[model samples]
Target chain A: MAVTMHDVAQRAGVSIKTVSNVVNGYPYIRAETRERVEQAIAHLGYRVNVSARNLRTQRTGMFTLAVPELSLPYFAELADSVIQAADENGWTVLIEQTGASREREAEVLSGRRRHLTDGLIFSPLALGPDDLPLFDVDFPLVVLGERVFGAPADHVTMNNVAAARAATAHLVALGRRRIAVVGAHEGEQVGSAALRTAGYRQALEEAGIPFDPALVGEAGLWHRSTGAETMGRLLDSGVEIDAVFALNDAMALGALHALHARRIDVPGEVALIGFDDIDDVRYSVPTLSSVDPGREQIARTAVELLVERITARGEPAPFRRVVPDSRIVGRESTGDVPAGAEGRVVGIQPGGVEPVEVVGR
Target chain B: MAVTMHDVAQRAGVSIKTVSNVVNGYPYIRAETRERVEQAIAHLGYRVNVSARNLRTQRTGMFTLAVPELSLPYFAELADSVIQAADENGWTVLIEQTGASREREAEVLSGRRRHLTDGLIFSPLALGPDDLPLFDVDFPLVVLGERVFGAPADHVTMNNVAAARAATAHLVALGRRRIAVVGAHEGEQVGSAALRTAGYRQALEEAGIPFDPALVGEAGLWHRSTGAETMGRLLDSGVEIDAVFALNDAMALGALHALHARRIDVPGEVALIGFDDIDDVRYSVPTLSSVDPGREQIARTAVELLVERITARGEPAPFRRVVPDSRIVGRESTGDVPAGAEGRVVGIQPGGVEPVEVVGR
Candidate 1:
C-alpha cells in the first residue's frame, strides 16, 4: 500500500494543504504544528508524491540514457558515471539499450517517448553522418561519442582521433617499428573506427614508417573475440609486428589474450596499447596500457548540458560540442612498468594517466 | 518540442477522439481516415503521450532494477540481460545503483519513490537477514541473490552454496587437495561469501581433505583488486595451496592475475575456479574455469516473476523462490583444454557449461 499525504494529514489532524506546506518546508509554519505533521509523516512513512508534483510542473524529474550496450565495459562504466551525475542533479535515469541498431537509435530520437522523461542522452553507434538530419528533432537531447557529427544537439565526446594518435605514438615511442593496428574497419571514413584509423596512420607517417595495409586487421563489432580473431589473423598471416594498437580497450584486451596464448612476451617482444581506459585494462594480466578518454568527465558534462537544455525556457541556447581531454595511461603492456615492482597493483593518479608500476605472468 | 495528438488531429482535419482511435488501432476507423491520420502522424512526428496515458492507467510501464554497481562486469552483464528481458515485456527499466550500502538498500525498499516504477528487482549485497522486515513493502518486488531470506516477495536466485560446491568439486576432481578459498568474509554467517565458503568446506570435507583456516582468504569487497590482494596474501603466507576457488569470477580473474604475476602455473601448480561465470572469465588469459550460475535465466525469471506480480489484481499469488540450475564451465585454468587445441576461443553451449576446448600460454 502507498502512503498518501492525506493519510499523514488525517493522522496529524491537519488539512492536506497544511501537510503539503509542512512537507515543502514552508518556513512560516508554527513549530508545534510542523512537529505534529512531521511526526505523523514519520509514523505513516509518507513520502512526497514526486509524480503528482512533476505532472503539475511539467517535468518528470527523470531522463533517458540511450547507449549501445551495457555489457561492454566502456558503456557500463559510462552508464555508471552518467547515473552518478544524474543522481547528483536530483534526477533518475531510465536506460535504453539501442543495441547499436539504426532503427532503435532512430526511435530514441523520434520523440516517440518524449513524454516519458525530461530529456535524453543518446550514444549512437550505427547511425552516422547520413542520419544527421534525424537529430533535428525538437527535444532536449545530448549526443555522445564520435558518431553523427554536427548534430543539432549538445554533443559530449572524446577526441577519438587525437587519443588514437596518442596511443599509436605511445607504441612508436617504445622503439617498435612494425606496429600493427587491430580492429580496423575496411573502406570509407567516419565514426570512431575511421577517425582512429586516420590517427594510427598519422602516427606511422610521423614515425617515417611505411603504412603497411597488411598490418591493418579488419574486424566487425570491435568485440574482444573479434579483437582476438583479428590479432590471430595478423599473427597467422606472418605479418612481422613489433607492437600492436587496438582501437578500443575491449579489442586490445582480446589481442592481449591472443598474444599471451602465443606465449609472446608483452613490452619485451611487442608493445601494446588501447583506447577507452575501462576498468578492465587495470585488472587485465600484465595490466593494459590505454587512453583515458575522460569517461566520467564526458558523462558529467553530458548530464549537465542536457539538464541545462531541459530546464531552459523560451529561446534555446546554441548547441555546443564538448570534447573532454584524454591522455594515455601506460601500464605493463606498453613497457611502462618499473623494475622491482612485481606483484604490485598501481593505482590511478587523479587528473592524469600515470605509468603503472607492475603486473604479469 | 513535443508533437501532440491535437497537432496530428489538426493536420488530419479530424477530431482529437478520431486521432486517438486511430492511434489506439480501433478497428471501426474508416480506411481512408486511418490513412489520413497516419500521414498526419508521420508528417507531424507525433508520439503517444506515455506519461499522460500512465497517469490515467496508474501504471508507468517501467520497473526499477537495483544492483550494487554496474562497473563490475557481473552486474553489467546482469543489467544487460535484465534490460533485454524487461524490453521483451514492453517495460522500460530504471536502474538504481545502491553501491551496496545498507542505507541505500533500505531507502530503495522504503517506497519513497514508489510511483516512479511499477515494481522492483533488487539484488542486495548489504542488507541481510536482519533486514527482513524491509522487504515486507507492499509493492511488487523480486528479490535477487543470496541475501535476506523469506522476504515477502517473489525471489530469483542462483544456488550459491551448491554452485560453489560444484566449482570446488571440479578443482578436487582435478586432484587439487590444498584448496584455498579467496574472497571469504570472516565470521560471515549469511550472504554469498558465507554460503560459498560453506560450500568450499563441504567439498574439502567430502574429498577427505582437512579445512585449513590459513587457506581462507577474507576480503571485504568481492572486487578484482581484493581478489588479487587476497591471493597475493595467501601466496605470500606459504599456505601451499594446490587449488584456489574464488567466490566469484571477478575475484577469480584477479586471483588469476596474482598467480600470473607470481609465475604460478594454473592447473599445474594450482588449479583454479570461480563462480558467476562473467564474460571476463572467457576472455581472460588461459580462460578461467567458473560456475555458470544461470545469470541470463535468473534475469529472465526475475523479470517474468516481477511482471506477473505487477500485473496481477486482487488477491496476491503465493511468493515463490526460484533458484535456477548452475554448472561448472571448465577452461584452461582447470586443465580443461582438449589436446592440440590452441589459438581458439571456445563458444558456450546452450543450457550447459561445456569444457572449453582451447586457450593459451
Candidate 2:
C-alpha cells in the first residue's frame, strides 16, 4: 500500500544510502545517480518517513504547543506568536488542547512526550506544585504561563506582579482611589491571579490606601461571561468604587459591559484597566487601557529555550526563569471625562524587572 | 538516546514479532507471552517507532490541518473544533500555517503530503483555479471554506452566497434602503468574497432594488484594519448609505470603530450587520448581528470526510461537497432603535441548496 525506501533503492538499482542521499538533498550525490533515485522515488510514490528519519537523526524538527483552549483570544494570539517563532526556526507546530484539565495536563508528560516531538512548549492552567514529580521525566521541555512552577525546564512568563502593580498605580495616578478588582481565583498561591492581586495591594499600600476585602471580585474562570458576572456581583455588593482593575482584558471588557448596563460612564465616574493587551481592546468602543505582558517575547523566549535544550540534550539541567518586562498601556478606559488620551506608558516596574539572572532576549 | 525494539526483544528472550504484537496491543498472543514482552519493554525503556508502524499499516493515525494563520479567531476556533472531532476518533492533529500564500498552499500538496499523516484537512485562502490540478494528489484530503471550487476532493464549506444573501436581506428587512458592503476582494471569481457579494446582489434583486457599485467597498484582506479603511472610504465617497453589511465579523467590528470615531450612531442613523458569528461578535459594544455560518458543522464534516477517505482508501473517488445550513443571528447592530433583537431566520434558500452533495453528516 505504501512505498518503502528499500523499494526505491531497488527500483533505482542503487544502495539505500544513495537513494536516501537523493531524497535528503545531499549535494555530494552525483547528478545522474540523483536523477535516477528521484525518478525511482517518483515512480514508486515513495514518501520519506519524517519520524523514521527523526529516529535516526535523534531530532524530530517539530514541537508541540499545549495550551488550554484556542477560543480564548489571549491563548490564540499566544499560539500565533509561538508558531511564528517556531516557523522562524524551521519547525512545524503541533497544537494540543488541554482545556485546563489536571488529568490531561499530566497525561501530556507521561503519554505524548515520547516519539511525538523534539520538545514541548506547554502553558498549563490546571496542574500546579503537586504535579512537579511527574516533570522528572527525561524530556526536553519548556513551560509557559501559570502553574507547574519550579519545573525542571526553562520557564518563560510575564512579570504578573510588577505588571499588575503598574496597572493599579495607573488608575490611582488618574485620581481614582476606590478601585474594584475582578477575576480573582480563590486560594490561588503562585498563579497569575494571586500574583497580580499581591501587586494590586502593593500599589494601594504605596499610595497610602488600605486594602478592602470587598473590592476583590471572584470569578470561576477568566472568561468574558465570568468577568461580567463577577463585576455585576461587585456592583451589587453596595461597595462604592471609583475605578476597576480586572486581571485580564476579557474580564475588563466584561466589566465594561456591566458598567454600561448600570448606566455608568467609563473613566468618568470610574476608571478601568485590564491585563493581557489583546488586539480587540484597540477597537473597543472607548478603547481599553491594559498591561502589555510582552506575549511575543514570551513566545520567542520559550521556543528559543526549547530549541537550546533540544540541541544540547546531554547538558546538565539548569532551572531557568525568563521574565519579560511589562508596562501599563493607557487608553480611553483610564481617561478623564471627554478624555480620549493617547496610548502612553502610565507605569513601569521600578529597577527594570528583567531579572538579572537567566538569559534575556 | 532512545531505546530500540530489538533491545526489548533481546531482553524478552523472544522474537521481535512477539514483542511487536504485545506493543501493538494485539490480543491473539498468550497472556503469559504478553506479560513477558511488557516487562521487557518496560525494563528496556523501549518506544515503538510510530513512522515505521505507519509504513507497515499505511496509516499514521494522525491528520494535518493547513490554514493560512491561527491569528485569525475563525481559523483558530475551526482548528479547535477539528481537534475535538479528531480526538473523538482517536487521532492527533498537526497544524501547518501557510501564511495565505499560493506557493505555500501548493507546497503542502507536494512537500508535506508524504509520510506525515493519514489525511489532511485544509482551509486554503490563497490557492485558486490555477492550483486546482495540484489537488489531485495521493494523500487523503478534505478542504474547508470557499476556495478551489471544483477540486477532486471532499469540500466542507458554508453556503457563502446564501449566507451572505441572508445577511444582506436581514439589513433590508430592517428598512435600511441604501446598504454598503465592506471586505469585497478585488476581482475574485469563486472565493468567499465573490460568492457573498453575488448573494448580496441576489437579495437586492429579490427586493427590486438597484445594484449600486459605489456601495461595494474594496478590501485586500478580511482584517479589521481593511474593514475600517474601506468603510472610511465609503463614508468619504459621499454615498448616502443607511446601513452596512460587512462580509465578516472582524470587519464589522472595525466598521463600528470607524463609525464610533466619526460620531455616527449604530442602528440609529445607520444599521449594521456582518457574517461569521465569531464569539467576539457577541461581546462587541453594540453586539453585532451576523450570519451563523455553522463553523462547528464545517469542522466536524471536514474531519469526518477525511477520516472516511483514510479508512476506505481505495473506494470510488466521489467528490463530496457538504454545505452546512446557515442562519442570520440578530443583535443590537441591525436592531431597531434600542432594540436588542433575538436570533431569527431572515431567509432560507428553497430546496435546502444541496445542489451536488456527496455525504452529509
Model 1 Cα lDDT, one tens digit per residue, B31-132: 999999999999988987554444535777888899998888899899999989988888877777887979879988876556567889999999987877
Which digits, one per residue and each the tens of the lDDT, describe model 2 over residues B266-293? Answer: 8888889988888777667777888888
TM-scores of the candidates in the order shown: 0.77, 0.80
List model 1 lDDT by residue over A156-254, tens digit each. 877777777778877888888899999888885778889899989988898898999999999888788898899989999998999999988899988
Docking quality of model 2: it rates as: acceptable
Clashes of each: 1, 0
Please give the distance, in angstroms, between residue A293's alpha carbon in candidate 2 and its true position after superposition: 0.3
Q: Write down the lDDT of every candidate, Cα atoms only.
A: 0.80, 0.78
lDDT of 1: 0.80
